[model samples]
Target: MRIRFKLDGQDVEVDVKHTDTLLKVLKDRIGVGSVHFGCGEGSCGACMVLINGRLRYSCLTLAGYVDGKEVTTVAALARDGELTEIQRAFLENDAAQCGYCTPGMILTAKVLLEKNPSPSDEELFDALAGNLCRCTGYIPIINAIKSVSRR
Candidate 1:
């Protein structure tokens, strides 16, 4: 099937098979390198992306699902080679280890901060619960998110 959607504010039109996962379409066909493929079972948030402003795991999402939606990734978080505040925080706090999960973590934190600029510890932790990071012990990751937090 032929589909068109907005990716990182850019129009993307590609032909995809119904059996193709969005993750494959993005990373393979579309050449988006940031959205990693970890657990194909949706247990890991490594393939997470914002579909129409809401988070969705690309690995579990069919390519047809995002036919007309807007998809946002960590790549979109930066503009003109300048990192977003969250990205800066992640770097400043040394949050990334292997960097495999940084994209998803940053995306999650971005959404959380967007919804609740001043999220409490519980809220912050809860938002990050879905995204798993095997490295960094999560301390620096949490601190990175909190660094740019308004509350």
Candidate 2:
């Protein structure tokens, strides 16, 4: 089957099998290496992506489910070779460590910031609760979200 969707601001059409998870199609067929597969069961949130502006675990989502939808990965958060404010904040606040979960975390934060802009600490935590970072312990990650929210 052929699936068509918008990826990182570009329209993309790729071949997919019925059982293909979004993560599989992305990393294998689409060559999007940033969508890591930590826990394919979706509990780890490592394969998170924005489908039509909603954060979803790509590992749990089928490629066929996203046809004609807008898919945004961590790679899409940059513009003209410049990082988005969320990305910059993550870097400045040392939110990423080991860099394994950074992509999903950043993309999740991006959706949260876009929707709330000035989310409270509780709201921020709730938004990022799904993304687990075993390396950073989430202190710096929460701070990074706060930093971007202020801007």
Candidate 3:
């Protein structure tokens, strides 16, 4: 079936099969190279995206589920090529180890900070529980999130 949705910041219309996942459609059909495929089971957040400002696992989301919805990826956060403060914080903290989980991490972190500008360290840990970063461990990632937060 053909589905229409807003990808990044632009409108997109694409054909997708019933079994096509959002991750597959984004990477294969739309050519969104930033969102990576990790577990493909939603266990890892490599396929995470912000659907209407909520964090969602694209691997588990059907392509049709995103129809007419606004999907935001890391690419949109920068807004015209200038890096967002969150991205810069990640860079400053060296949170991106292998760059596999960085997109998801950054997107989710943006949501977390948006919701709660002064989130506690525990909240940060809880917010990122779904994302697994085997390369850099969780310290740098948490620190990056914390650094960008009001607290």
Each model's backbone clash number = 0, 0, 0
Among all windows of ten consecutive residues in candidate 1, which has the lowest summed lDDT?
A: 128-137
lDDT (C-alpha, whole model) for all candidates: 0.92, 0.88, 0.90
- Model 1's TM-score against the true structure: 0.95
Off by over 4 Å in 1: none
Which lDDT tens digits does candidate 2 get at residues 1-151?
A: 9989999889999989999999999988878977898989978788999898889999999999999999988887788899988899988999888898999999888888778899988898888888899885599988888987865
lDDT of 3 by residue, 1-151 (tens): 9999998889999989999999999988888987999999999899999999899999999999999999988888886788999999998998886899899999889888888999987888889989988795688888888888895
lDDT of 1 by residue, 1-151 (tens): 9999999999999999989999999988988988999998888799999999898899999999999899998888888999999999999999999999999999999999999999999999999988888874599999999989996
Q: Give per-residue lDDT, candidate 3, residue 145.
A: 85
Choose 2 or 3, whichever is better by TM-score. 3
Tally clashes: model 2: 0
Task: After the best TM-score superposition of candidate 2, give how far the Cα of residue 11 lies from its true spot, in angstroms.
Answer: 2.5
Candidate 3 ranges with C-alpha deviation above 4 Å: none
* Colliding pairs, model 1: none
For model 2, give the 10-residue run with minimal summed lDDT. 142-151
Ranking by lDDT: 1, 3, 2
User: Could you tell which candidate, 2 or 3, scores higher by lDDT?
Assistant: 3
